[model samples]
Target chain A: MLEIKNLKASINNKEILKGVDISIQPGELHAIMGPNGSGKSTLANVLSGKDGYEVSGELKYQGKDLINIPIDERAQKGIFLAFQYPTEIPGVNTNNFLKTSLNKIKKARGEKEMDTLSFIKMIKEKSNELGMNENMLSRQLNVGFSGGEKKKNEILQMKILNPNLAILDETDSGLDIDALKTVAKGVNSTRDKNKSFLVITHYQRLLNYIKPDFVHVLADGKIIKSGSMELAEQLEKTGYKGIN
Target chain B: MLDFKPNEKEIEKIGKFSIEEKNFRIENLKNFNSVGFPNKLVEDWKFSDLRHIVSKNFAKLDLKLKPSKEENFDFIKDFEHNYIVLVNGRLTSNSFQHEDNSQIVINPYLNKDFSNKKEKNPLINLNYALSIEGFNLEVKDNYKFNKVLVIYNLFTKDLNENILNSQNRIKIGKNSELHVFDYVINKSEKNFFNNVYEDLYLAESSVFKNISIQKNRSNGFFHKFSKNILSSKSNYSSFIFPLGLKFDKLDLEFNLEGENIECNLQAASFLNKGDHQEIKTRVNHLAPNCKSYQKVKNVIDLDSKGVYQGKIFVKNIAQKTDAYQLSKAILLDESSEFDSKPELEIYADDVKCSHGSTSGSVEKDSIYYLMTRGLSKNESVKLLINGFLSEIIVSIKSKTMKNFIEQKLLSQIYEH
Candidate 1:
């Protein structure tokens, strides 16, 4: 469902992703493990179509040219990225922002938009499942949210959007044990036969809840090794220094 | 020194008015000289330099012929109520259709021998002596008028180029409610001047909401002043929305004379090109336990300029006064500029007063974020600008006025 070939990317005239390659099929869960400065976040940013980066590569999603598509177009094509640091927009309620974004995505996909009542109902249900209180939806988006609350809020958005390819970029970094389990449960409920995920993290603790199908060792912006779930267990025991 | 003198030919042309108006003009000129436009030495006019804008001769507009219904002064075509229409500076006969229990009074200046009070400002004296007509509208006590009172000030052309001097007085009796809409629409293309004065008196327990819409032509210059006083337990709300004009200045003063009175003043202006607009407001809490709120917003593009000066004063006797003032502006281009000054003077120790002023351009990071979401640069900028201005529009209590402002903002967006 996703393919990257010899992808070279740079930020501020400095190369970050040097000839990186990855491929994932439908229903597959891929984990990319790397140390600090291994270009993990840069990879996610490039896939999301953020500007200010010089990228030269061939990226295809379901046989479409993904590199040239805009960020919102990528989102409309069922691509979602859970940011490690969510933005805070003051004076804009979370529910209103989500409704506007969701309607735009639905309109782009030629789907019917929900009315006010249905929209409110959907938000109430999803927010309840994520353990978010009713008042959180009425407040400004992430204006004064705690660390754990922001992560859960991102999970809530992912569940509402129901994207085809979800990229969880260190979503478990700042979450507590309880929040981690809750977030993992939310992700597990949305997993389907046709959906895929690319989980990027430095620690393997999150792997205990959402197990990976395949684990790839990424170092110096290149994948050096690939194996089954056991590879994650081994990395957890011993750091990336010996494996590389 | 700036050249503040008016052209000799222009003064000679305006000398053809009726003998009464000519005499009034001479008296106003003498008064104007004594109180010439306050210079930078004055505190209130510190930021605004009036000498550059006010003419030397400053002739008063002549009273034109009586206006008619065909001139489109009727706000609601099918709906009927007491309506007064003023063209130039003359009140047309049969212009107002008075209903039962409502009194229509015009030109109180001639009826009552009232002297001009001592106001350090010269403009007050000039406006008093050269007042064309004063509208005295009274709604009977305990009477509920579901219809709105529309005062249409239409500017039409005349052979002589002179300044328009108009005054309006409105009184709401005790326990009465009324919705007053004052529209300043200019269709003239000549170099015209306007001086408008409005005085509102709200009785005890009465409710009054005034909305003023100014859409002047490119060649028009306007100077409008309004004073409102509220009685005990009364509610007064005022909104000023100015759309198009070359140069416009508005000065408003509100006095809370009774305890537990509620007052709100909101003004918004959108300008483009070489247009200039200024708004100055002062709210005074003279009674105990009074509440006042003020919000002023402006959006300027091209080479336009805007000025906002707001002041809140709480007297020593007025304890428990709660007042808040905010002034915000957004400049869309490098050539555009905005000047904002917000001041709070409190003599009471128990009063709560706060004022904030902010001037900024559109957030580039927010624009980039929107653009990354598949919107073009123009669309992103327009969306952000709309969101910024809609903060004031959403606060409007009238749905019709809100929709009107939305349409105006959209048109401005498209034009830019």
Candidate 2:
């Protein structure tokens, strides 16, 4: 569902992703583990078409050119990226924003819009599943949400939109044991045979909940190694130095 | 009216005219000379230079033009209560309609004995001397008016006209409620100057909401001064929206005279090229346990300039007072300038007073975020600007006013 061919990206004249290549098919989950300066987040940003980057090389999603699509269009095409630091939009309610985003995606897909009552009901149900209270939906989007709450909120958005490809960037960094499980459960529930995920993290804690079908070690802005789920356990036991 | 000659004869003649018209003119001139215009020399007005607009000769407008009722007056024609019409600072008796229960007091300056009190400022003295007509409204105690009170100030151009001045006074009785909608509409293309002074007195337990809409011509200059006095347990709120004018200045002052009084002032303005707008407000807490809140927002495009100066003062005896003031402005272009100064003067140590002022361009990250969501850059900027000003726009109690403001903001963004 997603492909990156020799993806070269730089921010502020500093090359972050140097000729990185990766691929994932439908119904499969891939984990990219790397050290601090290994350009994991940069890869996610380039895939999502975020601004402020000089990128080169071809990126294709579902047999279409993905490098030129706007971020919102990418989102409409079922490409979702859970940001490491979600923005706080004051005075904008979470439910309203979610409805707007969901309707945009639906409209792009030539689907009918949900009525107000049904929309509220859907939000209530999804929020309940994610252990989010009703008041959180009415509050301003992420104005004062805790670290774990923001991550869960991102996952809730993903579930609502039902994106084709979900990119989780450092979603488990700030989560406690309970929050980690809740977020993992939310992500796991949204998994389908047509949906794929690119889980980017430095640790294997999140992998325990949503097990990856493939594991890859990213170093020096390139995928130096790739293997099955056992590679994750081996890295967890010996760290990145053992493979490098 | 004095001639343009800088001779003692002209000054003496105008001085005599001022004394006969307003008894407090001489005392006001003394104070005006003492304080002058607070410029770089004065710390309080350091950020704002009033010297350019002040310290100059303003012609005394003559009440000669007759009232012309031509346009559709649907906004205020159906009111059952009494109303007054001011045309070029001249009050017209034939144009006004009065009801049985409503009494229209015209030209209060002719009946009430005028005095020169030490507390009276120079601007008040100038207005008192030059005001053509004053409307005194006294709502009966415990009286409830089913209709709204509407006052219209219509300006027209005449041959060789320079300026116009008007003043109005309103008083609401105890347990009475009043809604005053003041409209300033300009119909001429002349370079006109309008100076309006409004004084509102709210009795104990009285409630009053005043909404002022300025829809003047593009070439006209408007200066409005409003002073409100709130009695014990009275509630006073005002919303000022200035949309069409080349230069506009609004000076609003709220005096909390009695305990437990509440006052709220919200203002918004949108300016385009060569348009200058200024909103200056002062809230004085004289009694204990008073509350005041002020919010002002402005959007400037191209070479336009917007200014906001808000001051909150808590007296020594005004303990336990809660006061909050905020002023923010967004400049769309690099040439546009926004100046904001929020000041808090507290003599009471136990009072809770806070003031904040901010000026900047729209957040670039926010724009990128919205653009990524499929909205164009312009759409994203408009949405963020709307959110920035929504804090004050949503507080407007009138739905019509709220929608009008929303439309105006959208149009401004489109034009930019």
Candidate 3:
């Protein structure tokens, strides 16, 4: 589903992601485990088409150029990135934002947009499954939300969007046991043969909930090793430095 | 050294009007003679350069004129409200009337009497000099208005440059509730000058919501000054929306006369195509336990300029006064400009007062976040701006008026 070859990226004339290569097939759940400053987050950001980055290399997704398209175009092309720190928009309603986003994608896919009633019903159903309260949908986007609530809100969006490829950037950090389970359950419900996921995390705790098909250890801006789900357990016992 | 002189054309224009009671009119006109329509030299007129804009043209008193043709505003058709139409500063037809049993009275204000009031502004003095007709509204105690009262101040096609002046006074009795809307729609090509003054008095425990909308299509110059007085336990909420114009200025003053009063003043201005707008505001915390909040937002495009100057004063006796003021602007391009000056003068040490002002372009981070949600750059900026200004609109106490102004606001943005 995705291919990256010698993905070199830099910010402010300082290189962050050195020559790196990775490949993910359809229906495969991949996990990238790394320590601090190991370019895990940088890779997610570069793939999502964020601004202020000098990137060069061949990055393709679904047989199309990923880096050349705009951020919104990439989103319309079924790419979703769940941020580690979601922004708080003080005046934009959560439901309205989600609706606008869904309509954008639906329009691009030549699918009919959901009416207000159907949209509300669908959002309510998904939000209930994600354990999000009714009042949270009317509130401002991430404004004054608790740490766990913000992550759960991200999960709610992911469940509603149901994109072709989802990138979870530290989605499990700062979540309690209950919230962690809720996020994991939400992700597990959406797993299918046509969808792919690239989960980035610093700990092996999140892999325990939703098992990965391939686990890659990222060290110093490059993937050092790739193995099965046992590689995650290996890293939990022996840290990233211990493996090198 | 304040040197004031009146121009010859202004004097000639004043002579054209036949005055029965020349004493008050001449005195007030003489007061305007000394000030000569406030210029940049005046402290209050520093941001609004009214003298330079209207000095070359004279406000004519042409009585030999035909009634203006009817104007059809598209948004007005979608809503149902009582309408009082005025064209070229003349009352055309009013389908709405004050309730006789409800103690609400509406009449033409023809009072030439001058009072020893507190506000001493040159424009008010000019309005006082030319004010022969306007609406005087009064509501008695415990009366609640069931319908929204809309005053459609329309400026239809005009062939001459006229000076249209209006004076309005609203007095709400104790425990009364009223909602009023005043909208100005200009469709003429002539560059006429409009001067309007509003005096609002809310008795103890009364609630009043006032809204003003101004959309000047042609190159017109408009100015409005609203002075309000609030008593104990009374609440006064005022909202103003100015979409686009050639030249516009609005000044609002709130006097907290009694304890436990609340004043909310909000406004939003969207200007482009070299339009200029100035908003000057003042809130005086005279009594203790008073609360005041002021939120002003502006979005400037092209070479348009916007200016906001607000001040909050807490006296020594006014302890425990809570006053907050915020003014923010979003400049779309390099040519557009915004100037904000917020001031705080407090004599009480135990009062809670804060003021802040910010002017910047749209944040790239916010745009990127919205973009990642599948909204394009243009859509992202528009949505963020709508969110920014909608906060003030949602604060309105009247649902119908809020929805009305909100629809006008959205349509204005989308039409571009």
Highest lDDT model number = 3
Greater TM-score among 1 and 2 belongs to 2
> How accurately is candidate 1 docked according to DockQ?
0.25
Q: What fraction of the correct interface contacts does each predicted structure contain?
A: 0.11, 0.30, 0.60
Candidate 3: fraction of native contacts reproduced: 0.60
Using Cα atoms, each model's DockQ against the true complex is: 0.25, 0.34, 0.72
Predicted chain A of candidate 1: TM-score: 0.97
Model 1 ranges with Cα > 4 A deviation: A1-20, A24-43, A54-244, B1-25, B33-70, B73-126, B140-147, B156-162, B184-186, B189-191, B214-219, B398-404
lDDT score, candidate 1: 0.75
Predicted structure with the largest TM-score when compared to the true one: 3
**Candidates, ranked, TM-score:** 3, 2, 1
TM-score of 3: 0.92
Candidate 3 per-residue C-alpha lDDT over A115-166 given as tens digits, one digit per residue, 9 for 90 to 100: 8899999998998998989799899888899988999888888887778899
Predicted candidate 3 versus true structure: per-residue lDDT over B261-323, tens digit per residue: 999888987778888898888999999999999988998888889999899999999999999
Q: For every candidate, what is the interface RMSD in angstroms?
A: 3.2, 2.1, 0.8
| Top of the candidates by DockQ | 3
Model 1, span B166-200: residue lDDT tens: 67677888888877777666667666666677788
